[model samples]
Target: MAITKRGLVLGAAALTVSTAAIAGTGLHFFKGQALLQSDDSKQQVADADKDTSLQPMSMLSLQSFFNQSPKELVDEVWQIIDRTYVDGTFNQVDWKKVRNEYLKRPYKSNDEAYKAIREMVKKIGDPYTRFMDPQEFRNMKIDTSGELTGVGIQLAADEKTKKLTVIAPIEDSPAFTAGILSKDIILKIDGKSTEGMDVNKAVTLIRGPVGTPVKLTILRGTNQIDYAIKRARIEIHAVKSSEVQSPQGKIGYIRLVQFSANAPTDMQKAIKKLEDQQVAGYILDLRGNPGGLLYTSVDIARMWLSKGTIVSTKSRTGEQDREQANGRSLTNKPLVVLVDGGSASASEILSGALQDNRRAALIGTKTFGKGLVQSVRQVGKDSGLAVTIAKYYTPNERDINKNGITPDVEVKLTEAQGKALVANRDKVGTLEDPQFAKAVEVLGERIQAFRNQAPRAETKR
Candidate 1:
């Protein structure tokens, strides 16, 4: 939808404003980024006049603007996607017509607006680009912190089956305590069927204030189970570290669950502490890590790599932005990364960077293979839109969207063993976990080879 108020620039639409002209035009956006207009909304002003329902008056002065309407929300979502979707082609659909068609429709309620937003997003055929209601948006913000009030679990929609699937449950949270395994299909929430529910809607139904109760109906293989879990302030320690003695020497064991804003700082502390203990090498566990912030992943990648390209993002216009290490690595010791099918997004970024640069050996199954980058923007007064703004690639220029990164040594787990680890997360980094054991073995070889090259290493040298 072409919304022009004296040719006022909205998101980065292809109007006519230079980068300097958009210096101070914004409507109090998130983290202070001025979302601009893009070519998706580059329709002529005459198209806006054809709506008939909307007068020739500027969009800022519309009666609907003073009193919020569902139509207003619909146009806001339309504008954000038009400006930011990675594919300027809008997946080959006429972006301007889609916007014009949606803005022309009448929406009576917020639900109607949300429904229209979902329908409009479906045209792109990218599942990562979706809309979130007000409550769902707030919950997403809470997840950035290391704590939240909910039965901690990450959910996603299975692409092929379209089922509401569990990516992974946060360790020791209410959901994990109730034995929620990864890949379990959530059939219902509090007796409400989730046949066609989106992840945001399910998250809104599942999250509540601390000490509240919620029921979840899950489908695991051939059995349907019900779990009544109480909501609480689930503390998510993104980085968990300890020193484990191996034949190679003391090893730093660090498990990163989510790449939140605090991940870099926490990881630095772990690495520094392990270095003080003179650990020979490291084991970074990214198992069941549904990734968080994109920039956070880059920062962590730099901590392990003294010099290498971390990751790169290519926009619709073929402009690629690369993040590289600036020689500030925390340690230069050999490293082994643990990954599985749950390792996705930012997780893949860090692991892929390390693998591509030969900085670390990966031991586990293939990664989850989600390389798309989404930008979240505030829509209307309460809702938010997560639009896929770009697609990322590994340092080797490999696009791992559906095809995951193969581990240097694949340590596949049996269904029973996988379920057992899900049942008891405390046993994750121990020898009982087969992947960790393999990582230690592989790391021992690296360390031994590393020692052989030293001047007798002068012992600890």
Candidate 2:
């Protein structure tokens, strides 16, 4: 997939400007500094073998560790592991027995120990932190986020049902070609039942090196269909937009696939074309868009928010930071936005900002409500940790974490309705799609009302 011009511009700008501003600065700097000077702390634990409830291991040992290591990067981690394992009732876990079982053969070095420890952590039944070896780090760096090699389809386990279901398939993907529609109940993969499988485990089974094939059995209605698909590297082009003329030949429709580096430029071009055609209004489709690139979202918001703060970010230091709108502003015309469950993260940011400012009317179900901001911290080569570093508050100071942004108009799409719309665009019914229908109605009203008003002097010129 080719990169959008907007994304390319944003990427270049980020590399030239933000890279210097972000690199070797902020929390990452402190974290890196701390990691370098904590050797004695490790040694103290290495030497201590007894599990005493109340034994002081010597502040001198700690100070000496600090002096010799000069960095506290891994110090806290070392201390936590030591303290937790020593007296924390580790649920009667026998470390010696585990070591004997896993490490029956002689191990080569500390790398083996790291792997063993990682496996032990997994045995505790937590999925959050998995140990990353050098090879994993390399693979992660080469692949972009969310673009895994597998049959192209989105999967999610229903929170209530806890059953694995097909979310959606990429356009022109192998899954799409195989007639795997959304919401199909996945019964098995490679003939292995999915009854007790978690989504991540299923993901692990489905994803592998490119060119490998996997078979899936899905339940559609009362019938079961099998699909054999070859895994291939999938490149997700996160943004797509065009200046499409409305059916009435009055307004222009700009359907944005996702927010990416190229979105702003693509939007600019689309708007320019619409302007040239003397379009009446705009319908911006943000449905099914999982967002990307925070700054790109900011840039798009600047086009609408003429002035004032767009969003505020509170960092770990209790300092509140705000991103102000640049001089760039839109044409001050009627705008309608569409959003739904798939619209999350940066998409929510833009939608919330526009609604807060009354710059646009939002129509759809509640957003995904991920108001937390995460920054990537490079732990090692090609391996980084993305931890929630801050929570963003909208212009109205609304927190959208668990509770997503509520659309001005609520709409739900039925499976039959969606299929009809996708199959024959002419058969699309908006009566059931209240949110989108409302947007169209609202835009029509705006067009009628704005058409009667005197054109702005800037617009007239």
Candidate 3:
């Protein structure tokens, strides 16, 4: 359908252009007479408008607006816009410009819509209000545990050089075995320079069919090194456990990467394995974990806490509420959860739940408090809005948004001090960041105290 007079008028007004009478143009617009006469067409337009309007605006009492007078709704919105966002920022935001530039054009397919939304959201310049379509949102739904095929390497963008640099290579992965080392700058991938390349693009370039070849040009120290790296299927373990018969007897250490689809199953398996080894306690490492799935966090927290609300969400409706976690728990052992500024979203949920329930002591630095829960709703074909639908409150009713969760025992990262690991030598793992040492110290002390009370063990044969 061609642009309707109304659309053109709106578009032109947004573009600040003079409008002309565009009657009988046979554009997509339904003329006033035609619109009122055709019941089916009227219903179609109404349905579309209703769909957009009926969506409960985040933290806004949208349901109440339905029964409210226009003056009331407008007043409420104005007040909300004023109170939440100062300086009339909403008025300054060109939503019509966004709609015209991004959504006005009819999409050919969902892929087109998805691409458009991504582009639009990128243009918004707010990293928080992202567009995560159904598929992408589904991926964000849980922290599953499983192995994924990709070249295994820890990458970081150099602050000064702005080049993709290898922080470390995963053991036994193609990058490690292929001689990629720390501080090796990746200049290009398959002839494309890594200069100004984002992590997503680099990841896309790095990930391909297993056994396929990817050529990389790197700067090793001052010398440039080119290597033909054959991409092999690399397995990423979300959960790894090590049993140590410490001074306090048996202690189990479980490191969790991200919350993935298989995380619960893998965590259950880890727990059973630790139980079989008769582990006395556990050290759960959540440091550097960028949260994945909400369910995964809740599931992991449920394993340790058997009690009140794990997390609660308040929707757009002041009355509408959702909560999760039943009072079923699997483990009641002495627990220490490690956290850092990198630990976000789902990680925050798990840590907060554990802390709120008194099930575990949080060690390390403060967590990355991203308490807002996003719900992806399909707004257009192949495009969805990953809108911040609600805020999650911990079991203790604390909402950790900008203010992150502080550890019970605040330990900095400088003590672990791997000199080669420090990308920024000046601020490299400063005492302000030495999280690992704190976690180890906290867990180790707890284990030692427990050991002092335990019966002396006989020498093993």
Candidate 4:
């Protein structure tokens, strides 16, 4: 069957590598106008004139003044928080007091109101629950659409060092082509130091119109290098696959970069191709994969698991929603999953599901623990909010939020080893990848055991 390659649209409530907008919230705004009689309209105009603030002014002044009262914006944000914030008690901080505190200040401009709202949201003590201004919201939408005009690198902030670090550069992207290596510390962007810089802010600085150049000062180990890379439109490919010859036989190797919209379909094709080759088993690589859509992860998990719960989500109200897999295993062959520190969110879900169900053995280091889920709510036409709505658990009911998942076969890749593997990912196989080599060895044993246990029939002469 021919599989159609679809665009990688990020679904809502995704455990994303970066703080990209994912999933949708069912919030809608309606604008209604009331018609007034001629006399009533005239009276309203006179009443407006009586109020000096509402009186006629220059077009520019009028535009600024009537851009919806900042108080109204503040109230809108406050209401959303009051109704939908995961913690109803605002984590023991009096939410009403927070609202009153922000409202007490005079906010004549939308920028001021946004600042106030951000401050109020910050009081909740959840970094993921953030306020996205119009521009940030627009950029998030662009990210969800699975296309970006940027240098094409994912970034993360170190919890201890607080340095902006390169997570991974998109394959064939401008950043990758410019030799931007993973784990490179971003010291400066366009001459501005990245010390204490937020990942989203760094993203904003790095992204721009196509063909624009971005200068980056990177610290790789003991050497510091400066790179000038031009931005380009990046179409992210979430799934890649290959076949590697191992001591046992041909091993099917598939790498899932993220659980983007196209992931499940692309992965299905990859598995089908490998099955056609009659590979003994499969190795699913998820190292350096920042997660994407939650549903995409569930879908991918279902491809391997024929039964049992895939994942479950718990909300503040103690409501639990569980997703179960249908009995439709794509291949009954033995499988091994590879993961590392960079694997997170949806990546965790998929690996955890496979591991929990005994469908596959997880290799590599522990994963990045991010079990919380964010729901994206549209605040305005050009603005939105990503609120933490729920926490997800693996099928085994483990919540690996701060504490990550421990791989069955622990394998740690040194910095130099990782750089070498990443530098030649497409060509390098078991020879360059210790994790891959180990997985191949493990799978080879499993295949040999299966053959040894199979019942043999006597052939009639």
Tens-place lDDT per residue, model 1, 1-461, is 11212121122211110000000011111111223222123332212112111113235424444466788788777776776678889889998998898998888899999888899888877666778776565554332336556787777777667788777777778888888877788999999999977777777788777788889999999999999999887677889999999998899999998775567788889999999999999999998887765666777898899998988878787745687998989898999999988787788989999999999999999987777766555566656666676778999999988787899999999988887887777878989999999999999999998888767435674
Q: Which 10-residue window in model 3 sums to the lowest lDDT?
A: 15-24
Provide the lDDT at 268 for model 2: 73
Per-residue lDDT value at 228 in model 4 = 96
State how far residue 181 of model 3 sits from its true place (Å). Answer: 12
TM-score of 2: 0.63
Q: Give the TM-score of candidate 1.
A: 0.83
Question: All candidates' TM-scores?
Answer: 0.83, 0.63, 0.57, 0.80
In terms of lDDT, the best-performing candidate is 1
Compose the digit string of candidate 2's lDDT tens values, residues 313-414.
664445345777776775666788888776666777788888898878888778765565543323322222222345677889888865778988777777
Winning candidate number (TM-score): 1
Cα lDDT for residue 329, model 1? 92
Rank ordering of all candidates by TM-score, starting from the highest: 1, 4, 2, 3
Give the per-residue lDDT digits (tens) of candidate 4, residues 25-108.
Answer: 111110111111121122111110011111122343224333557776676667666765667787899989888888889987
lDDT of 3 by residue, 1-461 (tens): 11121111100101100000000010011111111111112212111111121233434343443344322322332232223221124325764465555534665555565555556544433333444444443222211113334566545444345567664455446765676654467899889988866444565577667788888888876788888887775555778777855555677878786565456767889988898988888889886565554555666777777766677755444413444556656666678888776676678878888888777789877876666654333232222233334567787889787677998998664423533334333332223335544555666676666668778999999
True-vs-predicted CA distance for residue 212, candidate 1, Å = 3.5
Query: What's model 4's TM-score?
Result: 0.80
lDDT of each: 0.72, 0.53, 0.53, 0.68
